[model samples]
Target: MNEAKIFSYGSIPRKGDRAKAYLYFKEWVGRFFEFDGARKEDDVVRVVLLASLNNGYVEGSAKLLDLCGQTVRNHLRYQDPSSFLQVNHELVDRMKRLGALSKPLTLAIDWHDEMYYGDPEAEGVAGTRRRRGSHYAYRFATASVLLDGERLTLAATPIVNEPVIDHVKKLLTQVSELGVKVKLLLFDRGYYSVDLIRYLNSLEAAVCNTAAVSHKGVEGRRG
Candidate 1:
């Protein structure tokens, strides 16, 4: 039998013949968890246990539905080499109906200044002093346009401290596989970077409608 990975938060089972090592991934801490079989590497076997933490803290064990099992599935399929990914707009619509998602597929490299809560009457309803509001660095890819001028989309979680390069890489990898094509990417003056532009170009994606005044040559033109 293939070695299996046992997942838990605190410690390994004491009575088991061998201890299974389960590490907590930064993305999935408390929301959902699963056991995956081990893979052979040289002379040893290694297994990965993934978990998604709930948005807010609770007294006891999280309810089964509180965890994002589909998120876990997406994560696993993404890691597989032979798998193909597709982002369906219909699926996104269904998620919206279920109130699991909101829309506006923009990526934010910086932090926002707003407060999020499960209850409107909760004590701290105003903006927090500790953290800014949530923003999207990268979100979903879809066959159909998910966001319209009247619609605003949102990310599942706030993306902070992540470089644009890494975000771009992940977006290109997953979105392309999902058959979602973006004709142009528009951004403000703050995102202007020669390195980022060049990288996007390498992937055959153009960086359109970026502020041009930062260049010395452009400055001369204003005169």
Candidate 2:
């Protein structure tokens, strides 16, 4: 039998604990996902879970599980991108239940630019400041909560010609719906737009700006 490995420390583990943990995640994901029976639905779930655990791409994960990477691609061919949003909500719910989010959290929102060398006219490509030898890039805004010494992602969305305020609003709305309270909002200088700053001032929480300008009484936090 294959050895079951759970990421617990030197703590004691009960018999069948590893199997139970594996089954728990499988069942949890199945609750939010569906696939055709002919899709080898269980294998689909296993592939996804393995890839996520490895924090690697599908091909790398498939090689470890002796699975053909094509299975993942075939199943995703007709999948709706937005439908997976619920899965994140479920994950947040689990963390909340475990008291990981018992208090207000400090959130850091930042822009991530991935340089795109392809034709700028291609869909989902946005014009960005010259960097990495490319003026055209794919931009993504990520919202993460400062937890312990690490950042746990709250939301991530591609910036495909959307206004910054609208994108921030959408991210905050998603967090609010999941019952998260904000202690402070941190912003990098990339979000130093007048409209965004004005919107942040309207919020009830303290603001930490990494840039020169900010609302009155809000201190600039330099990293």
Q: How many times do residue backbones clash in model 2? A: 0
Off by over 4 Å in 2: 1-24, 114-123, 127-138, 203-223
lDDT (tens digit, per residue) of candidate 1 on 1-223: 1112224534656453232322423222212222244232111111122111222222121223244333434444434322212113333444465554442333322222344534544442432343344321122221122353322222222233456456445544544443333444443343457866676556532323421212222211100
Listed per candidate, the RMSD to the true structure in angstroms reads 16.9, 6.9
lDDT of 2 by residue, 4-37 (tens): 3223322535676545555656766664555655
What's the lDDT for all of these models? Answer: 0.34, 0.69
TM-score of each: 0.31, 0.69
Report the Cα lDDT for candidate 1. Answer: 0.34
